[model samples]
Target: MQTDNSYANTFATDSDAELVLPSHPAQAREPQWLAFNAELAGQLGIPESLHTTAAGLGLYSGTELPDWIQPVALGYAGHQFANFVPRLGDGRALLLTEIIAPDGERFDLQLKGSGTTPFSRGGDGKAPLGPVMREFLVSEAMHALGVPTTRALAAVVTGDWVQRDEAQPGAIITRVAKSHLRIGTAQFVAHKITQGADESLRQAFADYVIARHYPLSKDRKHPYRALLRQIIDQQAHTVALWMSLGFVHGVMNTDNMTLSGETIDYGPCAFMENYDPNAVFSAIDRAGRYAYQNQPGIALWNLARLAEAWLPLLAKSGESQQQLIEAATELVHEFPIRYEAYYDQKMAFKLGLNSVTAETQALTRDWLSLLQDHALDYTQSFRQLADTLETNVEHFEKMQSWAAWQQRWHKLLTLQGDSDAVVSARMRQHNPAVIPRNHWVEAAIKQTVASGDLTIFNELTQVLRTPYDVVPLELSRYAEPAAPEKRVTRTFCGT
Candidate 1:
């Protein structure tokens, strides 16, 4: 694969700005390789000539670059929870270079947990083994579930320990993304505008985003407005997919929201077992701001920040500033409608209906109500719907309400004009049989972090790859919900 440095070479600052500075890892150790996603590497047309042993993965973790590569730490600002922070950037990460595949697709090859940068902000620039493994597992699982997300290219243990709560093994994950442009990146640009930066800078960044992710927008009558609409649409569909699979992104900060709409940060994310709309797993979310049910709203909030940043570009064609804000605000308001539409369509498929309507919506809502009221496992409930159709038995025999719901669902399926075979096939296609269940993820993390044994980690990662397929009985344990005591009530950011 070829490489590009457009972002570092064009947009990034060379000065020692508040959010941008040059730094390197305090220590780069031999990689105790845990995993490398060869499937993704193959798709990117990564040359086999560049392949290295597990221990050699550490070569990518340091400041020293291959002759063809140039590395830069990025700068941005984000709303931590709901409060806007003026500056936050690549505190412990670096954008090594943008790799161009044989197909001409560009992907940002970045190092997470590589080391300290100017944005480290007095904190250690490192990641523990647990979060590295968690990101690797869930990001790949999201891909298998057909969600667009940043893919994990490689994960290597740093063979060093970092103090977090207590001492834990340090590791680095090579994260691959279409681009690292976040809403917060735009926010940072807007901050610059507030400090008397020229409109030319804002337009340059907008042009860069259009070229990288939304090429069609460059030809539009008002490209900045077009870019905002495209981003809003992508984010709407992305959050809807997350909701369909019972995934909760514990932190929905602006910095964590990607312009490409791929789920970026996997820091405190989790998949729900029980179907509570208010489910929150991130320990730092004291007020449930980023709860499962609130994702759609928070996503819209983040997009509004992106819109604010692009106002200058939007107003360049002689439109009044107020008129531009009104137009962009109106577009942001449409996010909820778009998100709900996607959610309805996804839920309809999961309920074996080809189209959504008032009746189908009620059917879906009632089913979710049953799951919530009875505290039923989220993924299993939908997966079991197929089993119920086949055996004519209620999977949850104790929930009499489910039997009644099933009768209504069967009638709706008939009204929808699909045969049992067609509907069953559709439901199976959308409802995954496996997710990275919290308890199972915690178990795997324990094995690797506490004992340095990868047996459980390897097995779980392999099983999650075919999330929608029927698995061998030997791997059936992964399909089961955690016992009451085994549930992981909360997860951390692993900062």
Candidate 2:
């Protein structure tokens, strides 16, 4: 890896001292490399020599660190489910270092499941191999699908066991992100300010966020308000992309919500197969708070919490606190409008429309309603629709009310004056032919844990890299939805 001392502790400051604590990763008993994202490493200018050698394993697994590397555990607070917790930080992860890519993009290099920190909350900071694999695969898959997300750099076995129900093999994963700043981080600062800490802390943190993530906001008349709007726009677009791709981020807690608008935690996340809007896969979400269709609303809720955290800053120049609150509330309300626009545009593209209009929006909604009504596979339905446009095949012949919908769809394309071939090509570009199917992910993990084989895992990752492309014969199984008995109805937070 290239050295850039200037990028060290990019979020650190005297006022931010209390927000971060110096930490070191626990040494692994016998660290063994399991998976390394060579492609990502190359993109980030990480030399193959480093990753191929023991030096890479040691650095990534937290068994060792270079002198310039300053590892720290970030502190924050968050709302878990819907209840607010005043202190929830990086309990199992440390920001190892920051790397600047060849394209001049800065990224945080963090080690998850490395060891315990002050915020460990009396729990072991080790991650099981299953969640490690899940995050490594799914995060990369999300990146491949062109969604803004943190990417996995590597995974390794810690050569030590961690107890979670039964004794499970411990592992660690290296996560790369633009920054790990979250809504909880702001909440923590707000709490401090409320407790009569130096008001400068809030200003410093806000300045840092604007300078780093929302630099353009610094030029605005009301920079704090602009910052909130920009963050809302980013989150709305990101969550819309998640919904368009049938992704359900099971744990939509405030702490897991990144201010950078990147998808953070992959625990309990699953791609929706059957097109039920009420899908709930996270084992811990008994109430289905973060279900498939509830994501946009939950995202709005999280943004409200973020706005609340920024009350002091947003009110810095308002005529009255009530005025500032009202202003923030109005800004927060733009979330749904922006979310709906984004969702409509993406859904229209999936249905072979160049842009969203009233007609296109109606068509998209009707299509989703049909899918939900029939319990059809979400991803495959759109993919097969694209294929139907091209091949003129009766793939959806058994679907109820399909003939009527097809006639309407054809009429719209004919009205638009686009060739069926061109329309089909457009749809294929948006509707993915594959997703990181839950059953296959579990199967890959099962293989790795039972016999230490990575063939299935490697193959699945490859197929996910080109999700929108046509599936070749050998990789066809990856594109197929899981059989009835093999369906993975529940996903767990492997903490």
lDDT of each: 0.85, 0.88
Question: Candidate 2 residues 301-420, lDDT tens each?
Answer: 999999998877787553687888888899999999999999999998899988778888888888888888888889999988877865664547877888888888888888888998
**Clash pairs (backbone) in predicted model 2:** none
Writing each residue's lDDT as its tens digit, candidate 1 over 193-248 gives: 78777656778778888999999999988788888889999999999999999999
Weakest 10 consecutive residues of candidate 2 by summed lDDT: 3-12
After superposing candidate 1, which stretches have Cα over 4 Å from the reference? 13-22, 54-56, 316-318, 394-397
Displacement of the residue 412 alpha carbon in candidate 1, Å = 1.9
Cα-based TM-score, every candidate: 0.96, 0.97
Q: What is the TM-score of candidate 1?
A: 0.96
Supply candidate 2's per-residue lDDT for 359. Answer: 84
